[model samples]
Target chain A: MRTIGLEDIDDIALGSSLLGSGGGGDPYMGRLEAIAAVKEHGPVTLLDVDEVPDDWTVAPICGVGAPSVSLEKGTNGIEYPKVRAMMERMLDTKLDAFLLSEAGGMNSMVPISAAARAGLPLVNADGMGRAFPGIQQDTFTLNGVSTNPFVIADEKGNCTVLYTIDNDWTERIGREITTASGGQVTTLASPMTGAKMKTSVVKGTVDYAQKLGRIIRTASDAQGEEPEAFFLRESGAMRFFKGKICDVLRETRDGFNFGKVTLEGIGEDKGREAVVEFQNENIYAEVDGEIVATVPDLICLVDSETFVPVTTENLKYGKRVLVVGLPCDPAWRTEGGLELAGPRWFGLDVDYVPIEELAARRTDA
Target chain B: MRTIGLEDIDDIALGSSLLGSGGGGDPYMGRLEAIAAVKEHGPVTLLDVDEVPDDWTVAPICGVGAPSVSLEKGTNGIEYPKVRAMMERMLDTKLDAFLLSEAGGMNSMVPISAAARAGLPLVNADGMGRAFPGIQQDTFTLNGVSTNPFVIADEKGNCTVLYTIDNDWTERIGREITTASGGQVTTLASPMTGAKMKTSVVKGTVDYAQKLGRIIRTASDAQGEEPEAFFLRESGAMRFFKGKICDVLRETRDGFNFGKVTLEGIGEDKGREAVVEFQNENIYAEVDGEIVATVPDLICLVDSETFVPVTTENLKYGKRVLVVGLPCDPAWRTEGGLELAGPRWFGLDVDYVPIEELAARRTDA
Candidate 1:
């Protein structure tokens, strides 16, 4: 077990956004919320998967809805605990700890604040090793955790408990409820015993996020070097391209941001054009008309100079950024996980291929 | 005590629509579904409010959404019990009887079918003495029945449990979820004990619907009189005008049919014009540039010749019709009740004057 201090928030928040692959919402607000909560409530313990007892209940708390809406509708900081309380009511059992729904962007620290404020431990693992746009795009479903009986509460004290037959239905119905409840909500789902969570969640992703955050922070302070190159090497992410965002098409509808960004290559990657498509996160990326990255894999966009992650909602024209690709956890590479979050699931025409192979092919060419 | 048999569905369906004030849904589908259930399950026992035990749990089961959607998205005969079961799960207790959510339209018969299939008793009372499009416009709300902990289920077996602070929040959020879940959903809410049910609901409305239905059925078979006159006097309603519909401005949106119907006078009511506005149920009416009716009062539309109730959705051009108005129950006329469902609540510029008072003024003129 480890204690998450207020100082750890910056690195985790930055790393979480980097792992978000340009989705999971911007981390700025989450960082602020977490810092305030930790300062007020003191540091929080983060239990490892095995550290939790077999019979103890566990779940994740995260923000769910269109990422852009967070800016317009400032939250009351009440929905986080309400969601957890609602989950407890639904189950008639208290959760032993709050698990990270995703180790990406703002969501990663949402649980940190929730856990700290509630005096509940935070689990040092996550459902999605990295953030994915859709709720069903997690290892929990692939590992046989039921998505039934989750709680979603909006800032207005309006709450809804969702029960669906499958994970897909959870997304379909939950998204609609989120949209209906003013485009933003807090959700806690997949409640299970620590035994079930041990087998289902991606282990140590929170610590990985902290490590990535440390790399970015330390590298960010050094001058006269490409911080992104250092970030890529340390993150095991291969450099896809360095380019200026030429065009961005975006629309927020049905409680999600659906868009794509076109990148005009710069530096050593000159004369090559890349297109990255997203539904809240970068799901597919291609360069010079060749597929270089596709989910279930991480396709991260970070500022070229500072290595700070740029979320899909924050992507804009003329932003010089680095397109970085990293392999997803083995759980997502499985058949069920692939079907849950694959490029095919996003209605793309591309076939599934590992990020390493795609990078190797690009390098060989 | 009484039993609701399969034969009673026709009259109840017709009378229910009359009380719907031209809103509730078309009673045809509800009729067919209730009739089928009663035939399959024998009959439903209905207990009068006074006959119920103080401690027994009771609530209403009704349909929520745009009246138009029910025609296209046929139900699977599963959502009724699913809603009840969900409510039971939420409260963790078995309900003794099902109260009617509204006394008007298809909803009046929904609880009958639900009670019959579950073999539970149906209470001879309702929240809305006459249906008024929005959920918050019920006598139950004004009488202190909490609108929280309700269940909304779709035909697809997906369900949402809603918990809101006020009745208004229930409508705002519930409507959105209903719209999202294919524009129609089955809901059970305002759960209370028999003691609270007795004080909060309109007593004997179910039996009254049956009586009104029988009157309409008998009058339809009778020859050559203005049958609506008999329906009016027997049901304590007043005829506002007799005319042929000239124009209808209608749109189905946000899970409601919002519009107005204008009538050009005919026969004894010749040379007068009446315009009635509605949001789901008729909320206001004007005759010859004077306020004739406004809500928390029922403004029903029926065929002038046959006395068949015409829902707002069924209103069409050139159809000869009678405008009938009936006072809402005393529960909706109190200060709090009026504040909840009065003309001002519907954003009308006029004040709510009782139907009987308006009729008296017209007679004196």
Candidate 2:
């Protein structure tokens, strides 16, 4: 286990945002939230998934909602306590640790906040290597960890406890309640226990996020290099394309910012164009009208000059961005992953081609 | 209790689709699929919620996915059995009855297909009086019936059972699994109980759907009768406006068609414009650049000439449509209902208005 101090927040935010790939919601507020939590509660211990004791009671904590709305309705910071208390009440045991639900965006920071406040260790790995839109998308779904006894806490201090027979219904019903509660944010705690955590949590993600974050910053400062390049080097990502946002369309529905942005290629990508579709985060990145990156595969848009992350909703016409893609957890590359997040999964007709291959093509040409 | 016959299929399809208000998915396919099931297994028995014996084992069945995708992938009659058997296995009791999860679209018919084969009595009322995008929005969620031991059966005969602590996780994890299962059509059977059904269901929805279907078809056959007028006379609906779709943009994300469409007013609504947004069904409606009708109210768009229902995805530019609004269940107008489906719930800065007020304003101006 490693100790995480306040200094880790910024880097973790950047890395987690990259992993968000467009849909886990923004990490800015989450970072601020986590930093404030840490300051108030003290440093948190970050443990690898493998390091979790067999008896440790590890529960997941995260928020579900549109990032746009979150900005308008800042959180009440009460959900964590409510969910934590609910789980403890249900299981009749104190939570020994908190873990990230997904290693992307705001989700990555939630456990840190929860852990800091609860005086519990935080596991590094997440249920998903990248972000997915629903609860059933977690690797835990495959691992047979049910999302039951889950607690949803709203900003108004109203907490609803559901014991659904299945995960999908939880999402369906939760979404409606979430919408009704203002559609911005709802806190959920689920997939508890060490035995379950062993199978469900992706090992070593917390440290990975921190390490990924640190590498980008250190490499850039040391080499006077592009942060994006530093990220690509550390993560083995491939630069998909560089482009300028030409058009962006956004709408809020069912508690999400569902939108798309069209990009006209620039710089090394002068002759090409692309459209990056986002549901909170960019889920699909199409270059020259061909899908080059998709869900389950990490697709991040960064400032063309700085390589800093740019959220999908914030992208505007004429804003220059470099589209980068990284290979996801190999678990996500499996048949299940392809079926869950492949291009065809999004109604785009194409098999997934690694970003590396697309980048290699440019070099070869 | 009423015995449903083969003749009821046509009207059920028509009326249910109308009530679906462009969100419930295509009733045609659901109609045909159920018809085929009925043909093979005989007509399903429709029962009033009161008809259910206190001890009767009951389950609500429906598909969860992007409506367009559900139409394309097709049910092929696999999900019903999967969920039925799973529920049976989990509860250790024979499912004595089946019910529609919602009264609109394919969901209304999906249970029919299952009920016919299972030889279970089908409840007339649904959890949601109309249609909603996710699981938690149902009357069941509001009524405090957990959708647990819910079974999600995919087309490939792969079934995953999720036990979420709450309803929100069900949607997320179930959607992720559905996506992983190659975007397969899925059926979920949830909140199984006789007593729970009585409290959570919208009474008489099945009969309502059937009768609504009959009215529309009969209106078309009769000379000089308007379908909207028939709906108003029978269902207390108010004519909101008449317009042609001028622009539309949408995307299918996480198994849902979520977006917005703009309408250029025509006839009584000339020179005025509106935008209708949908998450499965029309949830927000704005007229003349002002918010008119919003959620918890039935916002419907019917083909101007035929009065056939128009789904969100099917709505295209140049299609003339009559926008109508109906007061939703009194339950929806309640504080809880407003919280669940209100305009403000969707992140819009507007208060909920009754359909009558919006309709009266149109005539006054």
Candidate 3:
């Protein structure tokens, strides 16, 4: 697998936006910020956790809480340094590298920025393979890794490190501060040595992001080829529906951008109205009264013409979009996965269906 | 402060019902389970962090996610052992004691159960004087300690430990797994040593629980005294409104009992309707388009006659309930505290008003 450069992040952001469904926040600003950091510090080396040296201490870098604040307020890139310094001081040793906490939204780009700027190798994996609203939504926690000695950094340049004895306390304490900090804060936490990383971090996410990004970018550049088609070819995603956004209702409450976006279906499914409800991320997709796609699987909305991601805030009246569905990591498809990211979990009473099946049904009709 | 015995937990559970305010689930089973454990293992000692040895590690124990599950499928004493073992394994030494993560519902009682079984001292203080959802909502996390090394135990005998690099990760991962686990899991996390506990854990919560419990029990034993008056004397909580539940809409989603309970005001505030919204715990109270008692303060609902807590699920049409208001921990009333647990946080558009003031306004009218 090839490594990603700063220029490659644009494609990743675009693809991530599509994968984000209607809710990964705007990826452009996060992309720009990541690119700026990469440009200043040089391309970061992406290392598989298996390749990490046994002695190296690897820390996951990311942001927490409501994505609205993360997008609107932006990040200061301060926590990374403070966490690094504190961890080194506590252990009396220099750190080895950084890892992404997840593959969705600004958090996906945060570690890359921190890795490049800090001169540390970036791990190619994340805790959760996708986006979630809280901290403990990762496979590592499921596998028993604590998110501790966690450091929280605010734009005001205040950095506080918590060396808690347990992960729940880490969440309780961190949430209070993040809530107090107005629902968005950046941090470096859950420090583990490379040996632990191999067992815990999801392998090969960095390469996947780079490849996904590259394919989308290259396909768009080729002879009027559609970016959505390129992404479908590369990631095996299926176009579930094509429509124009008819209505969008949003409210900022509980530090989350919550509401629904309705789309009027076109083509074979013309006259069908579908509504997708969102809370920080698109959780449920319903076409008319029937459930089409639910969470734990990717339900992404791509620009009909260019395949660029159309975010929830940007989704508006008459904007044509192609809704695509991709199966989440197999782990997310488990009973545990369904419970965490399934339809019923989000308040819907439908079982999950793959985008491919939905597309096949649509095409058959 | 005087020590509390296992015998005292039942009375505390009864009194706490009044304080829980039509939420906080039913503390009876948890308290009974805890009492049984304490009776079998001997009374657990309650200690202040400052009284502990310098090197002793103190972990906070609590059940995360929906309390409804606690009523349906009782929680076994597991997380405390898992956390204690994890810490012991980490330091190659046994933990000296344990602490409650919060003071409300089964959480307050669970720690005593864990302490009794594990032969660990139970700290008198909790992270929150009452309950609020999310790991980051704790005063300890707000002050500095991030809840980490979070140990979660499921009834299926699966115990996962998460060490996120940050507190948000802890919340995310824990919540995700909690969703995966059907929303009722026990967690032992945010372990701080005795040194930090002195400054971090909210002091005297366990003893306070015992005292409050004793007051209610004693009053009832003497003359079946009103639970409301007992609460008022103990915590300075005031009677805000007397009413009957007119409407209740319940939806169990994401492991949280989220929805609204509407009360038809009686007495001086008669003819007016009030709605209190809750997610795991009550966060907002409003009456006839006016914000009454918001979060970061106590919103208790009692049986108009018995002054006992009525779980949201148990609240039925025409059930008489007294809505009592009590001051929150002054720390929560601060700007930081308000942001973390205030009314706006639960999606209401209003500033927080002290429960006392709201009660006074009612009396004045």
Candidate 4:
């Protein structure tokens, strides 16, 4: 177990946004909420998956719906604990800990606030190492965990308990309810025992996020090691390209922000172009007509100067950015994971080849 | 108290269809399902609202969403009972009886099947004497009954329990979920005690429906008392108009069959035109440019020859029909009721003048 104080929140938020891969919503509001909660309640205790007792119940808590809506409306900070209390009432048992649905952007900070306010420990692992659009894209779902007995709550104290047949129905019903509940809702779902959590979750993501954030915050040109090189080395990520965003096309569809961005090469590789497409998160990336990164892997764009991550809604024309690709947790490489989060599932007309394999092929060429 | 056997299903179905006011969906499938359930589970016991024990819990059971979709994806006779069971689990108490949300078409029959199958009594009363599109249109809503703790279930055995701040949110969330659950969902909401039921519900609607059906089936040209005349006299209804449908325009919007139908008067009323507009149920009727009938009253179109009710989906050009307007229950005349089910609520221009007043004006003329 470890402690996450107010001082650690900024680093965690920065790293979480980087892992958001241009989605999972912006972290500014969640960061403020978490800071306030921690200041008022106390530092949140973080328990690694292995530290939890086998019988303890851990639930993933996060927000679902359009990120833009959440930005405008903002949470009242009361919804998360209420969601946890509702879940406890439904299950007739106290929750042992709260887990992050994704180690990305606002979601990463939300559970911290919930845990701090509720006086419970926050689990160190997460369902997704990086953000994905749909609920069924989680590692727990790929590992055969049922996303049943889900609770959705709004700021008005209105709540809904949904029991669906599968993860897909959970997403469908959740999305509809979230949209109807004024575009966003806080949810607690994918309740699993500690044993299940240890097997299904991507471990140590919270610590990794904080570490990544600290590295980015301290690194400078005078330090001799560039922030991009440090991040790529530490996270085992591949540097895809360096370019200036030339164009961006975006539309809000079905409660999701869907868009594509074109990046014109700079400096060492002038005249070449790269394109990234996203639905809530970056799902596909291509450079000069060749697929470089796809879903089940993380594709992130960072501002060249500050190395701050650029979210999907923040991506605009004329911004200089560095694109990076990180290999996904091994669980996502399984057949079930591929079927759930692969290119075919997102309707991309290409097969999923691991980022490592693609990187190796480029090296050989 | 009364026992409703398979023999009574036909009459009940016929009367319920007339009460549907061109909505509530067609009763054919529900009638068939109820008949089979009754044959298998024995007759359904009917108790008047007054007969129910003061402490007993009674819930209004019905379906929400597009009637067209319900027709296409027929029920497997499993959803209603499951919804009741889910409610029982949530409340941690046994439900005493099932009440019809509306004494119209499919909903009227659905509760009978559910009660019979669950071995519970069916209350011979309903929230609405005739069908209304939205949940807030129910008399119970106007009588200060909260529509929280409602349950929505689907044929796939999926269920959602919603706790909303008010009836309006209930309708909004329920409708969205119903649409998402493949266009139709069975719901049980507005659970009330027998004392509340006696004051809030339209009592003895089952007996009234059966009596109306018997009269319509027996009366003919040979009997010298026309169906329309007998209906108006017995139900305190008005003979709105007699005409052949000249134009029927319909489009399904937000899980509701919404449109306008034009009828050309014949014989003594030749050259005069009547128009009826609807959203799920008939909301307005106008003849010769004057509003003759408006909700929260009942406006129905019946086949001139057989007196069989023509549902909104079945209404078409060249059908000879008689339009009748029935005075709504007194509960619906209250300010709260009108605000919820008035002409303005459906976006009509005119204010709601009670059907009795319109009929009285015609008599003075």
lDDT of each: 0.86, 0.75, 0.71, 0.86
Query: Going through the candidates in order, what is chain B's TM-score?
Result: 0.96, 0.94, 0.91, 0.96
Candidate 2 residue B77 C-alpha distance from true site, Å: 2.1
| lDDT of each residue in A1-365, candidate 1, tens digit only | 98999889999999999888888889988888899999999999988888999998988889888888875675578897788888888888888899998977789889998999999998899999888878887888888787778788888888889888788888887887788778878888999898889999989988999998888787766566566656767777788889999999999988899999999999999999999999988999998988888998999998888888899989999999999987888988888888888889989888899988877776798
Model 4, range A1-365, lDDT digits (tens) per residue?
99999999999999988888888888888899899999999999999888999999999999888887778877777688778877887888889999999977789988998999999999999988999999778998887888878899887777898988898998898888887888778999888899999999999989989987876676554267766677667656678888999999998777788899999998765799999999999999999988999998999998877777888988888999988887888887888888888888888999999998998898899
Model 4 Cα shift for residue A55 (angstroms): 0.7
Docking class of 4: high
Candidate 2 lDDT tens digits, B82-107:
77776776677898888777767777
lDDT of 1: 0.86
The candidate, 1 or 2, that scores higher on DockQ is 1
Tell me how each candidate scores on DockQ against the true complex. 0.64, 0.04, 0.04, 0.86
True contacts kept of each: 0.78, 0.00, 0.00, 0.86
Angstrom error of the Cα, residue B187, model 4: value is 0.8
List the candidates' TM-scores in order: 0.92, 0.55, 0.56, 0.97
Docking class of 1: medium
Kindly list the per-residue Cα lDDT of model 2 for residues A1-365, writing each as its tens digit.
77778998888887777777766667877888889999999999988777788878777788887777765676788878877886776566788887788876677887788788878888877888777777667777666677776666666655654445577666665665567566755455564677778877677777677676776556556567565567677767678788888888999877678888888888778878888887766778877766677776788887777566777656778889888887777777778767756667666667777666766776787
lDDT score of residue B68 within candidate 4: 68
TM-score of 2: 0.55
* Interface CA root-mean-square deviation for model 4: 0.7
How many angstroms is residue B145 displaced in model 3 relative to the true structure, after the best TM-score fit? 2.4
Ten residues in sequence with the least summed lDDT for candidate 4 chain A: A219-228
Candidate 1, what DockQ?
A: 0.64
Task: Provide candidate 3's TM-score on chain A.
Answer: 0.88
